[model samples]
Target: MAVGFAVLLTVGCGQGPQAQFSVRDTTEELLSPAQKAVKKALDDGFGTPHELVAWQRLPVNYGGVHGAVGEVLADGKGITAKWEGDAAGVTAGAPLLWISGARAAESTSVDSVGSFDAKTKTLTWSGAAEPAPAAGDKLVIGFGQTLKTGRMVYMKNCMHCHGVAGDGAGPTAKYLNPLPRDYRSGVFKFTSTLTPEKPTRDDLTRVVKYGIPGTYMPSFLWLGGKETESVVEYVRWLSMRGEFEKRLDDDLSGDFSQKAIEESAEKALAEFKAAKADEKPEKPRSAGDLKKEAVAKFTNETDGYEKTEFPGVIDDTANFLAQGWTHGEDPESLILPSVPRVPDDAASRERGRRMYLSDKGKCYTCHGIQGRGDGAATEDFWKKPGSDEVYERRGLHDAWGHPLMPRNLTLGQYRGGRRPLDVFRRIYAGIKGTPMPGFGRTALKDEEIWDVVNFVMSLQYQSAPAPAKPAEHVAESK
Candidate 1:
């Protein structure tokens, strides 16, 4: 059957070139001018969907660059530096980095300075310096604010399902079983990293390159490293934009309603007419003029409100988003099972089976007795997150509001990964944005988890033979 299915797919399917691109607006039209200003500021500081923002990391003490820094040379024109160890990897037109306190008068481009010399192992920058670097102050080379190479790559590959805004609301998004990720929340489901931490670049890259199994996301393994990096950058950019929008909405939703704008415009118009009535020759005001005046008033109000309340909100939001991404890179966030995996033997499998059916583990409640993914939960109604109302249909639902089904382990297909550690992490961390709960140190013992892992791994094969019924024993008197 499997062979026949593979042949059918091979004969029936053929890949095609991607469709043409079209630009889409990402902003909500209802936003007031003040709200728009805040969003624009965020876009200008960060890059927009169409443009890439150029930025350099401060020194290690001043927030290190994306990559490492090497030795520096103070020349007559400006400063020149060599790439750390692997000098050949450095590309022309890359962004240059300087210590926080010491930087160039203007942002310097790699080509503007001079071509990198491989033999001499150095790049020469003859530009003028603002505050020159002190001796031993570290300098680094980088790719500054330039167009992101990944934007086009992502548009061509991901926009259909993931959407232009990375909100998982693309034209095809509604058709998929598990809806595509909404990067706006800055949260990802599968990660070796722990909770509250966003996936690292490598984590995002791996998923994009390899693709998730048993899902609509296809592998992009054909893409080269540069292309892959570009997609990662674009995805991160979208995530930042989404997060900024969310923060702005939270801050402005109270005072900037549409009704308030209309009411304010009417009041301004009435005041204008009343003042004009006193004039010897009354001048009439148009609706457009009234709207303009109202908008100006609204802007002033927003500015004042922001000055008093926005600073802390912006700071808190920025820290929350930045920390979420950075935490994934921390080593402490990884989940390492305390005990090694239990052996895939009969005894271990039986122990795991016993636990799976037990009331405490309750795996059977959702996964079913035969591991066929036909548990009663599939027939039951569930509530949507952040809302009290129940879903229209009966079944499990992910954070995205799509109907979700438990994995049928009998198929031997693991979407996260096939490795033991990969499965273990899924059990340990619980797939984020889904109903799966992590049963690590708190809920279950280390040994028991390993047993469950072993049993789950064994599910691909037939269930272990049931133990023989023992004969009833009878005591005899002599």
Candidate 2:
């Protein structure tokens, strides 16, 4: 085995390197003024990956103080504050985040404070806060450090393919056959969780540590425990942020899309033309007027959303994310065989072979008659999700819309894991974000699934594989 290290350094002679996260693929030209405003709002609230904003409403534990201001110093240094939480562990140079008032969305380091004073609270900083911290001005200190650490870890190790935003559109992403997993959608393929549930931290940990087999995602078991934890937290945070952006865009796009603005302009033009033709001295409305009216309407309508509804959306999205991840680790969400596996002998394998060829299992449809993965399903067109329209390409497609080929069992490679239990779970829970359907309690019995598992395990071992004879076959073969 060979190891490769990538050392990326900005080659500026005097200046240090600076990095910033890339925005989503939505281009500026496609957005109206209203859409641009929404994007700005999102940027301010969430911030770039480099300078992260620790939004208190999210599930991320940014780690900080929610302190209130006591008094602003006469001299342009710092202010006194009543810390809401304990500041015992904080050192002289710890970060002091400004949460509200004039200094909101700003942070400064603690220059000097001498000693902790319970009676007379004071904090001196390196720079003067322009509009000094007024009385009861809210601030949080030592915030976003975890996210920062996670970002560093992700950048050094995972960024080549995962991308800074976790959109899976990294520099090397396009060359890979099975495209990198896009965490923005919050869907993982090989999760232990039951259907519709997000992956647990353990699921992510397993994937990171062991890597997905038969794929470019190599193992990173050498990563330290703290590094692993930090990366997981970072991935989750990125996923949440991306999901939030997507949901927000969905809500805003109807009114703020360029099409909407164009439609509005067309309507206004028609009305103006009709009035002019009626011989009334109506002022002719130009395209600019229609746009201004659209922008004004958008501002008026979205003001409520920005002030009231947007916050609720944030809270709801966070709650939804939290619930999915939390419940994934629950015992009930896991898939386990009800009984022990049937012995891996001839009779079991034979039964499994029959089942594989039968209508009940129908594994041959995708895996092919000889388990070569060149099944007829790969030649047929599949419908896009939630629509009657079919995909442009001919083949099975995953949730990511990439043309997918079913696993070739004869190759003896299982992306999930080669372990018996892992394959069992794949069959039981189904591979999330893929066309592989689960055959758990709903479809196949535990013994039947085990038989199928045994048969699948036997496929690679045979010198020349073939289906069972005519009378032995219980059902029609695919």
Candidate 3:
């Protein structure tokens, strides 16, 4: 299979050695430009074993280019690009391609005015993870399909923060708490603590598969392995290319002194990586080490920055992170926003009470009927690595970097904060990368969200105790 694609359709049938043989001008043989491309591919060794993958569509008609050597001819005629030699399979149902045709009668051409890449390959449309389920036979896998998948993944996952080029400077980066990882820096925060070098592909896979624990990184495991693997591979490619761009930028920057710039590119680049190596990897230290270091590192002289950055580590600031390379089995010991219980709000509490019980809100499902976080969804259930003992935990965290318990509405401490506006925002934005989905995206309206917000705020209501039950009274009388 020809591995590359081109924007031009100048494949000259008349110019090459395998020039068009006398194509039987069958009366019923009117083929679209795309069909012609396929026919050309098929007629010229582009069929089966090497399936057809159209990069884009061709014009529906190209009858005017009779004088032009490579121009697709006639209505229903298409252009074909012959590979240099025998090639492997063309990805199935190739990406949506563009086709243009010349109007012979008018003696002119119209440009491609629209485009849309196929969302998913035909072949993998069935499923991923366990097995490839049945799909349309027309589906396929290969270069075109991979390219489209990569673009879709980028738009869906990386664009808002990673930027179109995989750099950290996305549109939303400025408003973020911790800035997005600058892929161009070549400094990844998480690699295997076991390995010193840059993270391997599996490392990236693990991140994509499980997602980063305490960040905006959302777990796309629902997208499944095939897409995940493709994404990982594409990310690696993007990272490598980004590193190349960094080099280009560095050279262009005035940072390099005349003497240093004169030195070979190899030496300068090597020195940069060597100087950066130690800073990039932070092996997980024991609890004792972290406690000791926390003490020493917290000293004003250390600027509280001696170990590592975690939320709330910086004194007298709204922002913080823990200090040093702390690692542990305790789920609570992570970067999160600390949130306290909601204070009393009688009126809103009543509304929240009803909403908690209602099937539509179903807040009780995982959060518990009491809003205690120990709902039936949690209790004893577990997701683990092929074992019986349930970890019985989901890796969610809060602003104070503690294990996020669902807001015990009774307690009133909402993790997003207890303010009505804060509560409304949570109901609206729905914590970007978590199981708590935003109802606003569906049928729920802003006012309804406000109602829920009002109810959540009111959970602090306290009423007088009820009278004793009759059974209890009889026992007392006896």
1 against 3, candidate with superior TM-score: 1
lDDT comparison, 1 vs 3, better candidate: 1
**CA error at residue 201 for candidate 1, angstroms:** 3.4
Cα-based lDDT at residue 236, candidate 3: 51
Off by over 4 Å in 1: 1-31, 54-75, 78-80, 89-101, 105-111, 126-147, 254-303, 463-478
Q: For each candidate, what is the lDDT?
A: 0.62, 0.72, 0.40
Q: Each model's TM-score, in the order given?
A: 0.74, 0.73, 0.28
lDDT of 1 at 84: 46
Give the candidate number with the greatest lDDT: 2
Could you arrange the candidates by lDDT from highest to lowest?
2, 1, 3
**Residue 47 of model 3: what lDDT?**
18
For model 1, residues 301-340, the per-residue Cα lDDT tens digits are 5465555566667656666665666666778887788888
Task: Tell me the deviation in Å of residue 337 in model 2.
Answer: 2.7
Candidate 1, number of clashes: 4
lDDT (10s digit) by residue, model 3, range 1-478: 1212222223323321221222222201321221242234323221111222222221111111111113222332222222222223333232212121212112122122122122321111111112211111111112233333544565567667776556666678767644565564344544432211344455567667766544566567787665776676556544443443333333222321222223434464455557666675434444344344434543335464322332211121111001111221123322222233234356545544555555556666656665556565554444443455544355443322223445455566544334466566556545532345455535355555666766655445534222222233335435
On the 0 to 100 scale, the lDDT of residue 34 in model 1 is 56
The lowest-lDDT stretch of 10 consecutive residues in candidate 2 is 1-10
